[model samples]
Each structure stands twice: as structure tokens, then as C-alpha cells.
Target: MPGKSGEIIDYIKNDLERDPQDIKTIVVTHHHFDHTGILDKLKKITGAKVAIHSADADYISGEKTQHGSLFMIPIVMFMKIIYRSRPVKADILLEDGDQIGDYRVIHTPGHTSGSICLYNPINKVLFVGDNLMYSNDKIEGPRVVHEPENYKKSIEKLRNLDMGVILTGHEQPITSGANNRLDTFLTELYD
Candidate 1:
């Protein structure tokens, strides 16, 4: 939700010409440093309630620490030096099937223990944060290796959803045939 350098707050206040305080809530997909780089600052400015899955709430709040894979150790250390995660206390603890405004929270844990996807049933749009990525004209799973079993199951759950547009945390969105793109990604995953 928060871009690096906490510029998103400025964009919301200046470019969007809106009061950050009017924001009802801030939804966090996970507690990864990249996703949460500016979260604490944003919350302070917006005075918005923070919502995150229970599994990751502690880590984000600085009550617990996160451990990455052996391969990610260096990357995590670098993030610590560069980004310096700020602790955030979640006002609302989310779970699968929970509704936040018009979006339904779908627990898609793989990239992180509390990773989630927000599906808007009315518009049929899904915001998948790092659970799936758009790459090379194809839909793909998380780039980093985490919980493969959970990742596969998460993708399968998405396969059952009636999605129109697929928005991801990074890269371009899949505007058309989201299910088809997901299907292709699934096939690749299973193979």
C-alpha cells in the first residue's frame, strides 16, 4: 500500500487533492518490507485504522520478528539497512471471507504467512498482492519461494473465483480473461 519513501501519502494528499484523514482504512496485504516500507508513516498521517491478517500482525507491530529463507537472509538484511521497517499495530485483524468495504479478503498465504488477495464481487476485480504477479504477458505465482503447498492451494482457490480484472502488487494488471491467465499460471505451476 505504501510505496518507498512514503511518497504515496503526498500523492494522496497533493495529487489526488484529498484529505488523508478522510481515509476510512488502510489494508495491508502482508508485512513484507517492500509492501510496508511506508506503512507506519502513512497511518500516522491518515489516522486510518490499519487492517492485516492475524498471522502477520505481530511482526508488523514489532512484537515479533520475521525469519526469511536462507537465500533471503541477505536480502532481508539489506532491507533492514535500506528501508528500516517501522512497527505498525493493526486496528483490525483480518481473516479469509472477511469483508472490507466492497472487497472480500481471501487469505492467499505463500509469499508470506498472512498474504491476502482482495476480491470485489460487485465489480469482479481481484487485487492480488504478490500472491500472483503479471510477467511477460503471463500470470505467474510469487517470484520468491515460500510455502509451495499453500501457494498451489491459493492459486486453486483463485481458479474457482469469477474474476474480471486481475490487479497485482507489481507489474501490469491482466485486464481481460483473468481466469484464463490464472489457468495458464496454474498449469505452469502444476507442471
Candidate 2:
């Protein structure tokens, strides 16, 4: 973090009274530029280990360009113009069932090849990163997916979990009744 962006560092020091070094790991949910744009810079400042799913590690490592639909080309380019992507290697390659802190990694691929959801069984909170959306009292799937079949399976996988809270990558979080919201969404999705 440099220039105006260093405010994150400043906030940590001034508000939280904590050092950037306190950060131990940077967990990335996918390869989207919006999620990983400043990852390289942040990693440098905090000296944190970068963790990303193995399927998407190459994109973060700059070994391969992000794969997406043709419609996303323009959106991706726009992201590049607004926020430059700085590739950084992942220190830990994660997979399904891996535990990061108190969260269990659920590989819900579809939105991206390595899209994931972090489930905390203790709190019954699920962190669905772009694999699902919650807004206007509704739970919806991603608008676009790289693999439609995988997306359906991912939704099915979520159905088996006992989720009370849903923290989404975008839109407001579903703070309660997460299971019911997901059920309604699934019904609508299938219909």
C-alpha cells in the first residue's frame, strides 16, 4: 500500500492501534481482479501469506490470464483501467475441506474455477463469495458463471449446510434465515 491507498495502513494504526504485521493471511475467494487487485501491494506491506484456491493460483501468480466469458472481456478491461492488477504468488494453495482459521473451505466453483465459500460451523455463518447474492430480501445466484453445471452443483452443495447467516461478496448480507432464503432462491432457480 502506497500513496492514498496507504489509508488502510493508517486506519489500522490510528483506529485499531494495531500494526499491519498483525495480519497473517490474505485469503482470496477467487481470481476476479476486484477481489485481488491490490493483493500484491497489501501482501508486501503486511508481510502476510497469500492464500488462494489451487485452481486459481496461476492467475494470481501471473502465470495465466483470468478465464471468463466473452461478455466479461469488457468488464475485465474496465477493471484493469480503474484498478491495476498486481500479480503475487500464493503461499498456501487451498482446497475443499481445508480449514483456514475457524472456517471450512467449501470449493463452490462456477462463478470462477476456484470460487469458494467459507463456512463457520460454530456460528453457522457462510461466506459465499460471488457464488451467491443477497439483496432486497432475496438470495440469488451469480448473474454470470464460467461453468453452469458447476454452479448448479455448488448450489446443491450449499443446500446441505445448516446456514443461519450469509455474508456475501457483494450486496447486503443475509443476517438471518439464510437457509430459507437459499431454499427460495433454489426453487426459483430451478423453476
Q: Which candidate gets the maximum TM-score versus the true structure?
A: 1
- How far does residue 61 in candidate 2 sit from its true spot (Å)? 1.3
What candidate 2 gets wrong by more than 4 Å, as runs, is: 1-7, 14-16, 69-84
Instruction: Report the lDDT tens digits of candidate 2 across residue range 56-139.
Output: 999888798877778877887676666665669999999999999999999989998888889999989898889997778888
- Clashing residue pairs in candidate 2 (N, C-alpha, C atoms within 3 angstroms): none
Q: Clashes in model 1: which pairs?
A: none
What C-alpha RMSD separates each model from the true structure? 2.1, 2.6
- Counting clashing residue pairs in each candidate, in order, gives 0, 0
> Tens digit of lDDT per residue, candidate 1, span 94-160?
9999999999999988888888999998999999988888888888767774677688888788898
Off by over 4 Å in 1: 1-6, 74-84
Best by lDDT: 2
TM-score, prediction 1: 0.89
TM-score of each: 0.89, 0.88
Error of 2 at 45 (Å): 0.9
